[model samples]
Target: MNKLRLIEMIFFLFCSLLSASQKPNILFIIADDLKASVLGTYGDKVCKTPNIDKLAEQSLVFDRAYCQGVVCGPSRTSFMHSRYRGSMGTNLAEHFKNNGWYTARVGKIYHMRVPYDIINGTDGQDIASSWTERFNSSGREAHTPGDYECLNLNIFTDKLEHRESTKMPNRMFVSVSYEGDGSDQPDYKSASKTIALLNEHKDKPFFIATGLVRPHYPNVAPEQYFTPYPWEKIKLPTIPENDLSDIPNLGKSKIMNTNNSIGKYIDNQKKMWSAYYATVQFMDEQVGRILDELERLGLKENTAIVFLSDHGYHLGEHGFWQKENLHEEVTRVPLMVYLPGIKAGRTSSITELVDIYPSLTELLGIETPQEVQGKSFLPLFEQKNKTIRTEALSLLTNGKGYSIRTKDNTYMRYKDNSEELYDMNKDPKQFNNLAKNPEYSQLLKNLRSQLDLRLKQEAVTIPQKIKKVMIYT
Candidate 1:
């Protein structure tokens, strides 16, 4: 070959190698029912989440990230498909699988009501086609042997047989601190499995999603986790006496009213809070384990990590204990992204969970599917001052109620036409409602118009085949 031709060939090969090496691995970590306010990184005073807080330091923390849905199934479905709640399509993992990347999910990625699905080691609403491989962690927490005390149900397992058939409210407060270490927990297994996957796929371009189930219902954690926060030191959330008085009847129904069962018993309430916080810390340790493995395997630099919750949880906020309301506590989630070269800082820009699909695709130079409805916030990674969205919308009760959160306000319009407006600038806690005030009539109208337009744009007719794929047992 001629000398000039050889030089050109070497240059072309070099460019190809550089481009191939630039393609990043994706590590998506999602937690269940973990709210933003409870984490140390998000300014929580009670819970000690050293691992997640460490992650926040090396990541770009999102200050106002909202989920598309209030509940697990719909919220997971929306973000996974990169569309609104009612839209239909394949999930993010499946899209990656089709694009020549190995994708895997460990633990609960879709909506599996914990303990039930954990016991069976089954996929609840997961899209089987999305994953190249999947693993479910079955632990002792799923079926606690006769020693644990369940405060919410007012039953000790030792006193009862056949715990599976025990009937309780869906929002019943349940908690237990097990006698053993966290090694037997499903989340612990999930972290170990994820670490194994990382070691196995270190050389290949891959997408690994680890879903940590903790701080969810039946709030159970190891005894060591519970020891950090004693019940006596646990602080109750400050609540106004007439908190629900201004709320409409529709809104009142959405708030958790069953707290009366455990309200009078302050010790029980403290125990529940302690359990939830302990679970958060336990989950944080699992996350630390996975992240440590990534760094140890030398995959940290090339892999992009996106950490967030499916939706926010309410721990006695707004007189509500569990999620399924359009309030700020239930809608706002903790979202942090770590790209290779992006500067680490917090951004106040409003964002949605659905935005994750496009942002990751854009960052990795992957072609996002045309059906995706979320806008990529990749620009914010470079310029944190820039704003990609004016507001974020969250659907509740399958669209029976919805909320629109803007920088200065949060507006909710129920299916019954009852309305609520909170001036976030003045009432950050969302205690006072301004919807009935005559002075803000025009402002309310404009927000309503924007919400209606958004709903129209996101609406999609679900195909039967897609619907079947979305159905989870």
Candidate 2:
């Protein structure tokens, strides 16, 4: 070989060695019911999410990511298995376990309580034979365990049959507000368990899941978290009396229910907002604790970090308290992805969440499952702010509403076939609905067609054929 060619060959091999030695670590952090606009970087104005904000600055932030379903169990289950809504069939735990991933959850990953749900060291909600090891921590208290109300307020109450302010159903041992150490309690437990797992498998690869239960309902956090924004300094959302007039009958029925009196008085909006921010602050601190360990152990470069929430929460918006309604505030979430070899410090308008399955596999150069419905967002990561998805879809079975959000338009389809369309560009708050406007009939038709395409593309799980046994000759 020529001398010049030899030198070029040596340099090529050197570059290959460097690339081969670097493999990113993965740290997936998900908040319970966080909204996109609540973070400091997302123009939250008051709520502080410094840890997540830092990640957002150095990672790819998805401005349009959404969950498969608005409810907790179904939404989380779909994302956990990376399967589309129709494909999950209420068996996400089983599907993920069938895959070759070693899954272990510390807290409320599968919509169940701690030690109570982890009876005999295993919760039946968890895939029976999937996890190599599992740990359940029910914390220290039960829901309304004998009626203790130190931070109870009228505005933050839910009208459900619970004795406490929130409406979540309570069981004998597993109830709301399980006692232990509050934020410091479960946050540390989850972080410590994850750290131990990372240390044990530093040389090998493993898939570990840690679930944090804060900023959900019963938004109880340390008093110190409230120091940043005093009640006087905080600004509550405006409640327009005519907000419902433009909405369709079906939309109004879904948003305003007889039992949703928790947010009746708009005057108490400040207290609810304060509780949300405090919970966010507490959740942020917990996130910092976990990330601190990852940084100290030098896992950031090799591991891919994905931070997301199940869905957004409404803080006195359209007279709603929790998710299950179709609104930007209740449907949008903050999603940040940090993969060392991939892209960093970028922003993508592409829809995220439930798409994690195909996206992660694509980033790692692997083939996606046959039944997965989410498209690979790797292309969008490479091209920041470019349109990966023309429109986004969110579904709710109880409300029978399928919401579609685009860059400039927001449309909702009700079970009764009534529609509510909002030109988000003109009204980001979504105070006005334009579905009845005859002028935009063409635009509505286009959006409806797009929804049809998505629905058909992701409708149901394709049945698998069973193999027959061959007889011996």
Candidate 3:
């Protein structure tokens, strides 16, 4: 070889080795539409998630982790950029990629719509700059050649049939018991692709994100996984008939007042629960497979694993079915971080999804960008009681709703001038709305003031040279 060519090759190899030695690989695995309440590590009395629970044993589990947006698009955009939905900034993976790290994403990272995006095989509102390489796993979704059924409507599709139309609205509520081992599922493909990428990029300093779409919509999982969650075994708490009465009209999800037959309500609830549990179990298995691969490749010791959900979902809570409502079930998500040398611990410290960006940068000794709005909770690894923030703030799209979650209370305000206040410490279930009660008048006043001030502080001007903006569909 010529002298110049040999010199260039040597220089490139040295740079690669230097980056690998100085930086840690990041494995960020986030589940779709998953609530913290269903996980075994999060005090779930029913679900058996051996893989994720085992991960919790080696990680720092945050019990009070919340999301900024009530729905997927805004919530994801908010965290991916490490800023509020209306603000403009560089996304998490893009930041690392710009700093000479190989960043890639597999499956649903940003804000892909569940069944629609999965069925059409499109990247719904995905930001292009976030990764060096990005992948989207397309499955038939509701038409995944399975035993499909719409529990509420008693509509059933044969296992041998494909969907008549992808535009079916009820597709989101349908559940499918796949006939095969689930290799055709999006999440399965995502995991397999993620494993492949890990092997190919094992030598480089990398930021790999694995987004698993399960327990999301169409609730497709293999028949073997469904065996553990039979309808007879599916259990839902008996909530009061008046449980949803106090919630304002704008604060309730569309599923809360569906037109389904009353006779099939309880049966449908159980069926939905059964499918969700089965899908969650299936998702956990994928996590186990990826972790095993990371260990087999000897990457575990040099990698930081972060497992979380985009936002929580309502599993028949107060007759609510999906997300988009600013309630505890839809706001509080699961967050677990596994840094190499830190011992496993659990904390109730209030955390938000936006915090992940800054925290990851801090843990890896990287300089956080000034535009990032999140506060780092890195101190909580050793000092569990460290106060990262006195309160966590969450909101609905376009500021339709605002919630302030403090240690003692959860105060929610809607655009219609209606309010709901629950003593989070004393009333975890939120059955009682103290907003109408005169006894807690003073407490309500203080919370409202806090929310107002917090909102003003969070509002910021977006940079004029923003590359792209995705409207939440």
Candidate 4:
């Protein structure tokens, strides 16, 4: 070969070697109850999320990612364990620790109280036993009074920390909030601990779960975070009065009336919004800090970062305060993956968070646990803008409810066997319920049958022999 051709070949080989030697670092950043559209990249007219916007610009954003459940605890259990609701059984906590991963957690990775949630306090109960190392940063709520308080359930009639306690709309009032060195807040502390862990474990491949507990509820933030957005500039979510008319009484009751700010529907909407935005901004800053540390320590090229929310929240949309509805606002969360070799600035409207576990395993070219219920999105990464799941299912408990969200339609099925279908493209807000319309009855029936067939396939129990083998592994 000539000298010029040899030089070109050598350069090409060098570039390939550079890429092959570096394993992508994972910076999985999750926001609590965050909506995708609330960020500037998602076209939020009023909100400013420069860090998230930058991340989104350089990453793949899933526009149609839906959670298995809307609640925090169970939603997280399924996400972290990489199992669908039916497949998770009740032992999600044990499955992680038993599996081969150096699972260290700093913040609310699974389901626990804010401070206690980061640690292991499920208010005398326990979080999922999924971590090889757990750190507790409890007791940040007392720093600022009247923000949100962690009420001791001992003063109440029941332990009240179980899923049953969250059956009603007012259940949010039970938890408390904290304030302080803002930097020393439990969530912040969790981030700080994560930086230290990353520094300590730079040599080994580890799974570090960091959960941020801001913008979830009790919207507590230090005064500094509140400066950018004045109360007067904040805009309230638009909701028509008749928004609840189409929804059944049972569905309406299950959703909280979140139009009011703070407790008892505070009249000052602007003040409440300021608090919420401040909390989100604070959380974003925390995310930036961790990312900075990851780069500073030269761990960015070796780790893989996956960021998501357990579920989305309703910031006064449709008069709802929290998740637990089939509405788009409550169902859509901010999900982004920053893998170094994967193409950047790509977005897909794929369905289901269950797909994340399989996707990660495929990206790393490793075998996923036998218990995983998700399919990997590696195909989409290779073939841009591809569909992962034909339909994503969301379940609402205590009411025998289920929803199937496809590319064009959303069908909600209730316990009484009544069904509602919406054309999401035309009626994005889901203001129209076509289930009862004679013209669409056949469509509804067809969707219901599809749901049933899918459920039956998912419901089949795993063989005990496999379980035994998995247990010993």
Best of the candidates, TM-score:
3
TM-score of 1: 0.91
In angstroms, how far off is 407's CA in candidate 1? 0.6
Off by over 4 Å in 1: 1-22, 153-167, 253-260, 460-473
User: What TM-score should be assigned to candidate 2?
Assistant: 0.81
Candidate 2 local lDDT, 78-185, one digit each (tens): 676665453333233333344444455666565543323422333525554545566664443323332222222341222224443222332211113223345335
Model 4 spans with C-alpha error above 4 angstroms: 1-25, 86-101, 114-129, 142-181, 253-255, 258-266, 459-473
Candidate lDDT scores, in order, read: 0.79, 0.62, 0.81, 0.62
**Against the hidden true structure, what lDDT does model 4 obtain?**
0.62
Between candidates 2 and 3, which one is better according to lDDT? 3
TM-score of 4: 0.80
Candidate 3 residue-wise lDDT, 1-473, digit = tens = 44335334433432343344567789999898889999999988777799999999999999888998877777777888777665476778988998888999898888787777887778887777888999999998776676888776777777545443345656656887867987888988999999999999998889999999888887888888888877887777657877778988887776653444423577777888888998999999999999999989988877889999988888677777788877899899999998775678998888888899988776665678988988877767766766777788888876688898998899999999899999987888888889999999999999999988887787433565554444333
| Cα error, candidate 2, residue 311 (Å) | 0.6
**Predicted structure 1: lDDT:** 0.79
Residues 117-200 of candidate 4 have per-residue lDDT tens digits of: 333434222354656686655533422432342222212222223311222333343322233458656668767888898888
Candidate 4 lDDT at 463 equals 42
**Candidate 3 residue pairs in clash (backbone atoms < 3 Å):** none
Clashes of 1: 0
| Winner by lDDT | 3
RMSD score of candidate 1 (Å): 5.7
